[model samples]
Target: MPWQHKIAYLIGKPVGISLSNGQGTSGILCDVSNGKLLVLEYLYQSQFALKQYDFHMIQDINGFPPCMSQRLY
Candidate 1:
């Protein structure tokens, strides 16, 4: 799927992201920049942090229900 379509569908939603490096994380999809970066707000060390991932490094993206996201915070 195209980035724009995926971005629009996932923005403001909780999602699980799998990266090419074999690492994964779940976070709220915050924004996209230059159509090549994804900004995700996630919990780290008991605090919420924003992280940016390169589009090409993402292997997959899955949406999680809002209820699941609530449990994180």
Candidate 2:
């Protein structure tokens, strides 16, 4: 399995996602399948519906409490 497949285990858990475009968001990993990702909601999104994004856009998974990562700058 690829790294993304392993990350699928995060389902139902909160994780920080850094996109290739340098944008970031945190949400519950609701689903990861068929080249798509379904998150419960981004950190700044107020609606409770799941949001979808292309799996390829995901650059990294910053784990829970994502702020633990060292600053890149």
Candidate 3:
């Protein structure tokens, strides 16, 4: 699939991500689009050096929206 399409699918779902370059740290998909992602509570070992992963999709989790809503003041 094209990169854009792949991003589209991840927009509203929880996904597992593994950074390809940096310490191979894995993060949960907090937000995603055709070009970027927001990982939440992410942590990796102390050896990886890359900043971003190569985009790997693990099994999708149930419950909770991929993106959370914020209250306006």
Candidate 4:
């Protein structure tokens, strides 16, 4: 599929991914590109502290969008 169509169709789904800094969290796939994925509502730990996160994208899931539904309900 086209990149635009892939991005547009990737807005709502769950993806199993990790951060570049070695953190773990799961959320809806909000956006995508050839090099990253915009994941919403992410979670991770840093500097010995727990943190809430948003807008995280890594290099693993690069071309393929999340293979799940975005809706939580």
Candidate 5:
């Protein structure tokens, strides 16, 4: 299976997404299928919305409480 399919296991979990356009967004990973990503973004108190993104536009993906692979110091 492709790496994207592996992300399906993280469904319902919050994640940070980096886009090819140099933009970034974080949200709950709702679903991933057919080269599409469904994210649930929090707009405000008691308000939320779902956004769809093309899988191809994604540059990187990281989960919350990010961990560094290398020492910064």
Candidate 6:
């Protein structure tokens, strides 16, 4: 499977998203796709809401897009 799809499997896991723009958003990895990510109860730029973000637009999946690392995203 592709790494993008691997991110989809992270549903229900907590993850911190770091964007290429130097912004970060943290929330439960509710859903993922080749094009986007759905986050629930997310905290970004001091804002709170449920929003879907583009995958390519993100710099990193804070805890690791797959959460396989010792330090979870």
Top candidate (TM-score): 5
lDDT of 4: 0.49
- Selected candidate, larger TM-score, 4 vs 6: 6
39 Cα displacement, candidate 4 (Å): 2.0
TM-score of each: 0.69, 0.70, 0.33, 0.36, 0.76, 0.62
What residue pairs clash in candidate 1, if any at all? Answer: none
Which candidate has the top score in lDDT? 5
For all candidates, the clash counts are 0, 0, 6, 0, 0, 3
Query: What is each predicted model's overall lDDT from 0 to 1?
Result: 0.75, 0.77, 0.43, 0.49, 0.85, 0.72
Query: Model 2 — TM-score against the truth?
Result: 0.70
lDDT of 2 by residue, 1-73 (tens): 3447557578788888889899988888888778888888744556576888797898877458546667789
RMSD per prediction, one decimal? Answer: 4.6, 6.0, 9.4, 9.0, 5.3, 6.5
Cα displacement (angstroms), candidate 4, residue 41, comes to: 1.5
Task: Give the lowest summed-lDDT range of ten residues in model 6.
Answer: 60-69
The C-alpha stretches of model 5 lying farther than 4 A from their native spots are: 1-6, 66-73
Query: How does residue 69 of candidate 3 score in lDDT?
Result: 78
When 1 and 4 are scored with lDDT, the better candidate is 1
Local lDDT at 43 for model 2: 47
The digit string of per-residue lDDT tens for model 5 on 1-73 reads 4447557676888998889999999999998877888999999989999999998898877778866789878
Candidate 5 lands at a TM-score of 0.76
Give the poorly placed runs of model 1, Cα more than 4 Å off: 1-4, 44-46, 65-73
Displacement of residue 59 (Cα, Å) in model 6 is 0.8
- Which residue pairs of candidate 6 clash? 15-73, 63-72, 63-73
Off-target runs (Cα >4 Å) in candidate 3 are 22-28, 33-35, 42-73
- Residues 17-64, candidate 3, lDDT per residue (tens digit)? 434343323334456544455555434565433232224542222223
> Per-residue lDDT for 1-73 in model 4, tens only?
3233444555676555555577656666766544455666544553232233333433233234445867788
User: What would the per-residue lDDT of candidate 6 be over residues 1-73, giving only the tens digit for each residue?
Assistant: 4446457556788777778789887888777655789888645587767788987777767444453557656
